[model samples]
Structures are given as C-alpha cells and as structure tokens.
Target: MHDFKSNPQFQKLQGKKVLVTGGAGFIGSNLCEALLDLGVLVVCLDNFATGHKHNIEEFLGNDRFTLIEGDIRNLETCQKACNGVDFVLHEAALGSVPRSINDPITTNEVNISGFLNMLVAARDNGVKRFIYAASSSTYGDSKELPKVEDRIGKPLSPYAITKYVNELYADIFHKTYGLDTIGLRYFNVFGPKQDPNGAYAAVIPLFIKKLMNHESPVINGDGSYSRDFTYIDNVILMNLLCLTTENQQALNQVYNTAVGDRTTLVQLTELIKKYLSGYDPAISKVEIVNGPNRRGDIPHSLASVEKAMEMLGYEATHSIDKGIDKAVKWYVENQHSF
Candidate 1:
C-alpha cells in the first residue's frame, strides 16, 4: 500500500480537520483511516443506511475521530458535520443503478438533494475545499475508447444521472460561491472493507466471497463487459492529492480517478479464481454462470488519467492484478468480519 505519511505533500494536512460524509461506508471508512494515519482530525457522518457501524468501529476510540450518526439527506445533519471543518470529503450517496431504477425518487432525493445540502452547508460554514466522489457512469452511452472529462453521453441510468448532476452542482458552487472544489470521477473502485453480502455489492468483493465458498459466481452478461477496475488505494491517493496539492489549477475541476486500463469480466473472474485458489484449490474448478445482461450496464469502460496526472501529480500505484491479489487475500483472512 502507498504510505501517505512518508510523502511530504500529504504531511501538509497533519493538523487539519476534515468532514467525510458517509464516512462509515466502504470508501469513506478507508479515507477516514488514511486521514487518521496522517495525524489529521476526521469527523465521520453516516446514517448506517448502507454503511455499517463495524466499519468505523476501530476509529471510535481514537481521540481525533468523531462519529456523527446522521443522514446527508437531512440539512441540519450536514450543517452540523461541516461546522468548523477545513475540508469536506462528500462520499454520501445512494449507489447502484438497479437500486436507483427501482426507487429513483429516493435516489434523487439523496444523491442530488443531499449533495446540494452539503454544498450549502459547506458554503455557509466557509469550508476551504470540497472534494466529492463522482462516478464513471457519467460516461453513459458514449462509445469512446477512453472516457475523457469533457466528453460525455446521455445518462443510461438514474444513478448515472445523479452522479453527473453532482459534477454540475460542484462546478456551479465553485463559480457562484468561490468555494474551491475537486471532483473525482472514480471507475469501478474495489478493495478491503467493501461489503460482500449486500444486494448492491460491487463485483470484486461479491465474486471473491462466492469463490471463497466454492460457489458458482454469476456473470450478468456473456463476460465480455469491461471496466477500469481501480483499487481503493489509488482512489485514496487521488483524494489526498486533491486535499494537499497547492496548485490552484487543480481545483474546480473533475479528473478521472482510475488506472487507465480495462479488464473484461471473464478475465476478472479468471484472476479472482487464480488468487482464491491459493487458499482453496477447489475454487479453480467452480464454474461461472451466465445470466441475461443487466440493464444500465455499459459494454466497456476505460479512462484517460492524463488530466489527473497533469493537474494533480497523480500516478496509479495499483494495477488490476496487484489489486486483486491483495483484495483476495484480505477477503480470505477476514471472512468472519463481513
């Protein structure tokens, strides 16, 4: 894993206070842990809707860690979390395309309305910077090989629409309120601490869990769908860079936070099996089942990180192979936790 403490750039945030919305969830929890390691104060705001208490359990005892049990959809809760915070790492959202399709009203209320609430609170509280989790789904139906920041297509799902709106809102907030912000359009992020049992669990953890039990993992399509499978550490690095970088140009912009490579679902399954077989050889024999193609799923997704590289001095530290190895090991050893 990349060590933030050893980097002088990250050392700049040692005494700052950061409010991480949805800080009890997978990516949010990992960001909290990283911030704590850098000797920074972390305020975690979560409602335990999709996030679990156990995820942030270890940080509860830390003096610098403060847990606010609240939902982002509540304006007062968002205001309370932003009070006296130097920066806002807004990670709260209702993710998953299918879940949004089933209930877009709620999704819109949370992802869009709640995001606006955070912007208002951040503006009112005089937050120095606002960094948020954008999504790759914003690429939508664009058939481009490498999804660039400026180029996009019509949203294919309600969830995609919400994420794209977040970018627009953040941009408007910056221009209208002079509130510096950075938006990270994350690709398929996966790693440790991600839930593997939820209906909306990400592909990596879900597949790992199934293979660990010697069960057949189901593919939503013919296994040809591809994604730029980014690791949590890379996402963490991008957030930290956005927080610490002094370059003024890096602010008020959205950058692709990914490895800039693609992997087919079939290749991903094979990789998972290979890694898990190290723990249980029988997993290698388990067959992969194919189901009808899932709605709102893009056939292929890739990213161009040239912008992040040029603007934020970003470099991906984990590739798909290295990431899968570490993720598989984590799931196998920490099977009882989930």
Candidate 2:
C-alpha cells in the first residue's frame, strides 16, 4: 500500500520464505498480505486462540501462502513452523494489559514461554532474522514525552513484563546464539481487520463500533490521556525495512515503530466522529462519557522515531487522521458482518 514495490530494498524479499506467527491476528494478517503482494512465500502459523480465521480467509487461496494451525506454546509446533523459513516475524502473543491483569497465568505462558520456544526454534533452524512485536507498555511510569528505544522504566502490568522480557530474550539470542533479531516497540496501532468485539479490544475500533451503533462511547479517564496512535501501514513499512535493510547497525537493535506524534483521547474521538459523520450524520450527535480509568494504563505515551529514521530510513505514510478516515470507511462497509 505504501508502494513497497518501488523501494528496490524490498526486492531482496521477493522470493524468500517468511514465517509470520499469529498470522490470523490483525497486524499479522496484514503483514502476510503485504508479503504475498511482494511475491514472497508466506507461512502463517496461528493457533486461532485470540486470532480469528476471518482475518486470514482471503489469503487461503494464494498458492504461495501456507497456514499451520498450531499453538506456539508447544515447542514442537514452534519448531515445525520455523522449518525451511528464511525469515521469522514473531507476532504471536496474548496482548491487552487488562486481560493480562485478569488472567496473568495464561498471558505469561503464551507471551513469555511461547516466545522463548519461538526463539529457540528459529535459532536451531538457522533463520536469517527474527523481527518481533514489542510494546510501548514497556515504557511504564516513565512519564516521558517521546519514548526512546534505550530508555524504559519498570513494567506496570504482566503484559508489559512479558513484552519487556521479549526484548531481553531477543538481545540474549543475538549475543549468545548469534541469531540476528530486531524488536519494534509498537504504540497504539489501529486499522482495518482489528477486532472491535472483544472484552479487551483497543480503544479506537471499540469507539468506532459504539458510534456506529448510535451508542455513547465511554472514555476510560478524563479524556486527557494521550497515545502515539500509530497506523498499521507505518508498522508494515517498519517491518519491511527491518526484514530487508542491509544496515549492520540496524540489526539486533530495537526501534520505536510509531509515528512521532501524540493525540489525546478527546481529540481522537472528535476525529473519529468527524470522519464517520460524513457517511451518517447521526454519529456526530452521539454522546461521550468519562468513567473510572482502567488499571495498568499509563497517563500519556509518545514515541521518538529518529532512531528508526536514521537506521532504517523509515517514514510514516499514514498519520492518525488519514488512518482514521480509511478505517472508518472500511468498518462502515463491513458493519453487517460484525
């Protein structure tokens, strides 16, 4: 979507075999689709626990696309998925801070132990690179304006701890096992195919659903807390850069995979309504309510993209406003299914 074919750097991945774990999830499915567009052989390994089959239904017919139905928690499954793979994009993990708070045991098993199993499998299989999905939650309690790659604070939740542990594991694998790895700390990524019907769904899609249904959308706090609100296209570009870049310094380093911007919850709601109202005027009249803030949520979060820009020549193609406009149109067209 970002004219990936024009970038000669991505030509290196044209015929490579790439494995995308959690390939049935929102972000993973998008990556699989893009890789397939580049004529890359894609292997999608998903247990369908939190990820849904609907997300990957379209790719089922692609001859170059393969789906393995198994859990990452099992070492055998992880090893099997890594076999004959040239590169590994590790996206498998139980996300959501509140869900982790409610069920920390399952979260730890899937996010930490499952992640370790993947690393071991990738190392044994001689995979060229392992790019993983890290989280901004790792910046817990830092109160920093623009989150940097090196600076972080104590984890605020079990989800945060699991993600931080992922960075540690990747670093160790690079140093000890000689495996090439890169970690991308994502911030509030949202777009099409993101599920809005879940107990722990992200704020943007959840709000869009409520407004479309003509129901009042509830804000978790006083509507002052903010996020970087990265778009999925930007995330796809960063992963592509990490996958194909020849820069030696970029390897084994973590990057903030986010737009260098922040938007308050209040501002985000207004943006959503502004876009959706064009299709249905009633959405603009929907009320917003403030409730008690959720636990394990940082008051404010933003990311510094300088490291990604300097190291990988990364650029954000879709700002939050442009991303929201595209996402709202998609949801409106697909509302009947949800």
lDDT of all the models against the reference?
0.95, 0.95
Worst 10 residues of 2 by lDDT: 1-10
lDDT of 2 by residue, 148-178 (tens): 8889999999999999999999999999999
Candidate 1: list runs displaced more than 4 Å: none
lDDT of 1 by residue, 1-338 (tens): 56878889999999899999999899999999999999999999999999989899999999999999998888999999999999999999989999999999999999999999999999999999999999999999999989999999999999999999999999999999999989899999999999999789889999999988888999999999999999999999999999999999889999999999999999999999999999899999999999999999999999999999999999999999999999999898899998
Clashing pairs in 2: none
The C-alpha TM-scores of every prediction are: 0.99, 0.99
State candidate 1's TM-score.
Answer: 0.99
Superposed Cα deviation of residue 206, candidate 2 (Å)? 0.4
